[model samples]
Target: MVGLLPRFRRYRLVLLGLFLLLPLALLLGAGLGAYPIPPLTIPEILLRGEGVEYQVLTALRFPRVLGAALVGALLALAGAVLQGLFRNPLVDPGLIGVSSGAALGAALFIVLIPGAGALETYALPLSAFLGGLAATLFLWQIARTPWGVQVSVLLLAGIALNALVGAGIGLLTFLATEQELRSLTFWTLGGFSALTWPLLLVGLPLALLALALLLPLARPLNALALGEREAFHLGVHLEDLKRRSVVGSALGVGVAVALAGGVGFLGLVAPHLFRLLAGPDHRYLLPGSALLGAILAVSADLLARTLAAPAEVPVGVVTALLGGPFFLYLVLRYKREVYRA
Candidate 1:
């Protein structure tokens, strides 16, 4: 424990740096758009609140940047919890079908509802949240046994459900009208272009609630890392932990998908990177993953917006491009470990 103290202190400093970097990233993201406000002037514009720069910052960039951070943090934290719970580094919200499930719900809403009205605005997120919860419950049921939740079975079930949900989304796509198809396409590609304050307001509470629930599980997760039987021997409530983590992750991921479309790989990449930096202690990993995920999302959004300079690539596309190779590398490097009991 004495030997570990130095490493823990170093890791804490790293986390502190990440926390500080977040605001800087947010400020930078706010300033780097089509109009290109200077970073130094951003505070003045925000304070004055009367000029074109202020309008762009407040009306456009601020909400989007804030939304991106929240969505990123939510997704990354969910990923860390799922990965810890399953004891598999590769598992993510998407791997377990929650994201696909949410996408299916969102796609269904887009295809079935035909209007830009209040009902449509609210209905999509509600549908997505329900879909994610349903999928999570289904996966839990499929993985449960008289003995305990089977991690292997859970992963397999998630893959199967993801495939099934993907098929549903495809069916929705096939049946959608032209405009709806366009909307669906953009959504799957994933961007924050459509983020608004109202959507943020709706999602914030769910994300925060999820975080609150998950953060407390750090110790239980650490105990579980010793193995389920051992964790139970140590008085960890295995069932409660599983239920809360899954439910919290589902709620957070559902809201993220509802708001930002299908931003992939942020969860997988962020947690893994933090694990490398902070070791696998869930206490640090969870919060560290959230910070790194926010940075990755904001950076990706920045590139997505400016890379094409008025055209804007999907943030999802950017994350996929970044995460795909890392995922492949993880598979190649850890295939044996992942397959081991």
Candidate 2:
């Protein structure tokens, strides 16, 4: 214990850096948009409540920035929890088809709703949240084992659910009116600029509640990383921890999907990146993941807004493009170990 304190202190310093970086990147993202607002001027306009610039900064850019930051942090926090839960370095929030399920739900609503054109703007996010939660519950029921949860079973269920949800989304797309189809397709691809103050008001509370709930579980999560039997020996309740983790992850991811439409890989990458930088104790890992996730997401949003200029590239596409290659590498590197297991 004595020897570990120094190492822990060092890790804390690194996490402090991540916390500071989260807001810095958010401000940077907010400042750089189609209008090319300056970063330094953002705070002044926001604080002083001046004229037109203030409105742009407050009404539009500020909300978007906050939304992105919250989504990023939530996804990353979920990722850290999930990776620890399964003891798998490759796991992400969307690993188990939660994102697909959410997409399917949103698509189905768009297909079925009538004369609800104006509501269509916000319908997808709501649908996605419901879909993600339902799918997680369904997966949980199917994957529950008498001997305790099996990571293999959980992952397989996610893959199967993803396929089913993907197919449903596809069918919805095929049947959609051209206008609805365009909207649905863009949303499924994931982007963050759709944020509005009202939407943020709804999402922020849910996100905060989820994060607050999960934060206390960090110590238990770290214990579980030592293996279930070992954790039990250390007085951790296996079932309770699993319940909290699954529910918390679902809640966080659901809200994030509601806001950001199936943004990918931020969860998987952020936690791991921070773990590499700050070490694996959940006390550090969770917060570190949030910061890194924010950095990755806000940076990605910046790229999405700027890369195509007037026509934005979907945020999901950028994450997939970056995350896909890295995922492939992880698979290849772990192939032998996976096969042996």
Top model by TM-score, which number? 1
Q: Which pairs of residues clash in candidate 2, taking residues 3 or more apart in a chain or in different chains?
A: none
Per-residue lDDT of 9-67 in model 1, one digit per residue for the tens? 97898799899999999989999977799999987887886987788888889999999
The lDDT, on a scale of 0 to 1, for candidate 2 is 0.84
lDDT of each: 0.87, 0.84
Candidate 2: worst 10 consecutive residues by lDDT? 114-123
**TM-score of candidate 1 relative to the true fold:** 0.95
lDDT (Cα, tens digit) per residue for candidate 2, span 1-341: 99999889889888888778877888888788787888998777778878877877788887887788888889999988988888888887887667877888888887888457778667768888889889998988887888776667888899888888878877888889987887788877888888999998887778888898777888988888889889999999888887788888888989998898878888988887776676888988887888788889888888988998978899999998988887787778679788889
lDDT of 1 at 44: 82
TM per candidate comes to 0.95, 0.93
